[model samples]
Target: MKSAMMEREGFAALVLRLRSEGISDINLLTAVEQTPRSRFVAHHLAEHAYSSRTIPIECGSFLEGADLAVRLLHRLRIGAGQRVLEIGTGSGFMTAVLGRIVERVISVERYKTLVEEAQTRLDQFSIRNVILRQGDGSNGLPGEGTFDRIIATAAFPAIPKTFTEQLVHNGILMCPVMVDDERCVMVRLTRTGSRFEREDLFEVPYLPLTPHIASYL
Candidate 1:
């Protein structure tokens, strides 16, 4: 009953909100609009799923923002057959979108239930090639292939050491950073030698890093 209603709500969201907001990427907007945000949310919050505003979800929350995932991906200048590593898998919304656009993705989440449920939702869309793992997102998935692009859904106080260690040279790291009160910004980092070049982009709000989960390593 609720699932059916939420599914319908997601379609409505695509038409009313996401499309009109300049989220004109054919594949991106289509993937988000088609993907049921409600299914990824808790049952209690299902009714609010379609709103353009953010909705709370398990562990933390997920919201429809400026399409930071989409915008950051564009900043990467990703090319086909590129491998991506996504931290903070969240509702797997970003993961599914990346799967459609990239050669492959390895997405990690701290919560087991979120990972399981997100996997189910993504599978419903026939999204293959997104490998989901349960682990600490702050620490990049060990032995996961070198990523051409890395994006984190969680806000970074400063760039995490693990994520930077895993990137291949010339790769891009895109995520939100806390600069100061009312000064939060999403930025892009490109590695050059041992240093990183940071480019500030737009404002974004995101879940903070988590220190604990059963899968923490």
Candidate 2:
């Protein structure tokens, strides 16, 4: 077992790696420093928690590594008091980061198990700014209204119309879009009046965004 000192050093090293990857946002680095990746990772993988790599969670969903998390947050450029919508709660690590930086986060996950687990993790941190729901994230959260920023942790072949429609003018929607059957790219879409402009940021591997809820399994 790694000592507390060792764990801290590990995370510190991870931060250096994140900086090397071009994630220079101090706020994001601070959030990562405050949040312990082990708490959101699988028990079996706890020892590797501080490593900058994705870890599988329940229902085949994966918690994005510190690098991707920082990159996404960097692209969204979320600010305090901004209403944000997160499309995949997964292990709730990113949700926690969003909660620390934004006014509120409405996170939707298709897996009931993941929703429940994520809620539990966030509650442990006393993070009260998150609203967790089990539903089809591809549809976006309608009753909650539009958001200043929308981030989908899953990959979609194309940005869903509902997500674009739910964004206020000038709002940003960041998600991984499928480039082909086996590859995906990170895309940022800024709403401008009745239309949205797309910018491809980087290539990444993420689980496919699906419409069906995995409630029964």
Candidate 3:
């Protein structure tokens, strides 16, 4: 077993790295530390889990690093007792972090194999509040009801109407939207009484969010 002091030191280093990147939420950082990125990454790449690098998963999808996840969650401002809808459940790392701070998480994935793997990863950590579903995540989960916050792990050519309609009044949706063929920007959409306001956060690179179930393994 690793020494308690070593764990603390490692966690503190992670917190510092995230803080330097402008991820100021202490709760989010703690959740990231507790989730341990190493647990969700492939065995060969486990050593670099905490670094801000995208890693491949079972399918063609790449797991967004802790830095991206932290930025998305911080902008969402997830709070206790709130329901969150996550667009991609890659490796279930983000799902686990949101589960720690939110009442519930409804994560949708396009690949069945990825869904199963992500579910197993969450089970390993004993995280029970995330509802992992296999389907196209471009359209948010309707049956689960409107969410207080929604985060998309993949990039979309445009904000889908379905997501805006499913967001509760005063709810926020954070996602990376493709501005051109090659450029993407993280945006925040807030819904208030049928009106939605948009704010662009920053530029980011991510795979396109597909509407069809993935055929590629």
Candidate 4:
């Protein structure tokens, strides 16, 4: 009814804003439009889901802004047939969106509670292509095999060798890394044989990627 229509309008506005901000991929924009962002956030903060601002989720983590997520995904050049590995599950908002764009997604989160909650949301959306794992994302699921595209939602001091090793040939890894004490910049590493081509995208305000599984939320 009226509420559903408002939600549609909000998503439409969000898509428009994203396009203006340099998100040219039509499939990426459609994925963002179709994913119900409110369902991935707390009920009280659902109204702000469409806003380009970070929202706090469980386990003391925050969901990156929708715009930033879209921009990163766009830069990754994710294809429909590629398998994607995501480092931080966070609120599962990006996970859900990734599920729509890629062929399959394996997402790892340090917090068990977040994984469970994210699973529930993914189930609600009928997103069957995403598998949620509760583990240290810094390790990047080494035993599961390499992926076509790997993305880390958090910042790292430097790209982890484990992550780079988990990328298949010609695969891309997008992540934010600390450039200095006060700054973090998004970087793209493309694996080619024994070398990884590095490209720094832009400055971002992402939290540092942590190690080890959380003992408690």
Candidate 5:
């Protein structure tokens, strides 16, 4: 019989799969496995929450690969004692992960219901480092000036120009840009002597960048 130890081994196996998908950071993997992803997703889909794939949540929003998100953030060099701003808080999974590693996080979402639900889920986990808001992410979080890091989970046309202005000098901005009708491109923007540079990564398809809250962000 496969005992609990074997089941734990299985969980490790899933983590290894994350590694294969370009998530090479050890701490990010641990956080991905440690966070109760199942708890954040719908109850009906909880069983597969740890399966290293995206799970559909309410409001048409989806929980992306926590492994990928963690890896991207790590590559961006996010660390303790810095303020970070996230544009999308779908399930609050990434928010929780960032909360653990960063000094503080201000995550913006457009859908009221999605924001409320994610806030409730994250609050249950006692993740106090993240601040949730309902707003237009495309415009960027106004009056929340000068973040040490800015990350957007939604797919956008390009890194919003406003985001570059909001980032502190020497800061980094990460987002998935739309390459065509459906393909997603991971865009990494790092400040260099007052300018920003971008690196495009693999394609991913996520919910659109809801410049306008449309009942589904």
Candidate 6:
């Protein structure tokens, strides 16, 4: 009983920190509050789940920092009725969060092990809206049909045109792109008719998005 109370307190504090960081969306905050991030992390690292720092997951990938994930999600302006495409599943924490906010989410990951593990976590949370697929997301999954929003968790040297092409008219795509040899910046692209409008959000530190499916874990 005491442990449950502590977990609740930790989540409450996390919500406050996100709000202080300028996350003003009530629904997003509620989703963040309700989702148990601990369930998405390794048992030994569960204590750090509610903290803002990234936690190592399987497949040599790291769950993105909570602050960074929330900031990006907020900027995407995700609507409850929209369908979102997530380029990286990571620990499935962000996938669960997006599942809570959107009507449907199709997340692709390069590692099959990560996909299976993430599916287990999502199942534990009873999140029925998310579909986890194992694939290379360097170029978005065009066969899944267009989405209302698309977000890539890894960094890219430049915006991949294939990803933008997969967006529905007026759909939004958020990603991190290398601005120089030493720096990566978060970028937002919105599809309008035959053109895409671009905006650079902020600098971020992320490994470049890997291409092709992993042959082994």
Task: Give stretches of model 1 more than 4 Å off.
Answer: 1-23, 42-50, 64-79, 181-183, 192-195, 215-217
Local distance difference test scores for all models: 0.72, 0.85, 0.83, 0.87, 0.76, 0.87
76-165: candidate 5 lDDT, tens digit per residue: 787779899999888888888888778899999888888898888777878788899988889678897789899888888776788898
Q: Which stretches of candidate 6 lie over 4 Å from their true place?
A: none
Model 4 scores a C-alpha lDDT of: 0.87
Cα error of candidate 4 at position 179, Å: 1.7
* lDDT of candidate 1 over 106-151, digit per residue (tens): 8888788778888998889898889998877777777766788998
Assess candidate 1 and give its lDDT: 0.72
| Clash pairs detected, candidate 6 | none
How much does candidate 5 score in TM-score?
Answer: 0.87
Candidate 3 residue lDDT tens string, 157-204: 888888898899899998889999888999999998988899999888
In order of appearance, the predictions have TM-scores of: 0.77, 0.93, 0.91, 0.94, 0.87, 0.94
**Evaluation by lDDT, superior candidate among 2 and 4:** 4
**What's the CA RMSD of model 1 in angstroms?**
3.7
RMSD of each candidate relative to the true structure: 3.7, 1.6, 2.1, 1.5, 2.9, 1.5
Kindly list the per-residue Cα lDDT of model 2 for residues 1-217, writing each as its tens digit. 4656756987788878877877777877777777788888767887777765788777887877766777778889988889999988888888998898899899998888988888998889898988998888888887788999999988998888888889999899998999999999999999999988999998887878878788574
**Candidate 3 TM-score, true structure as reference:** 0.91
Q: What lDDT score goes with residue 31 in model 6? A: 89
Judging by lDDT, tell me the better candidate of 3 and 5: 3
Look at candidate 2 and tell me the lDDT of residue 44: 83
Error of 2 at 3 (Å): 4.3
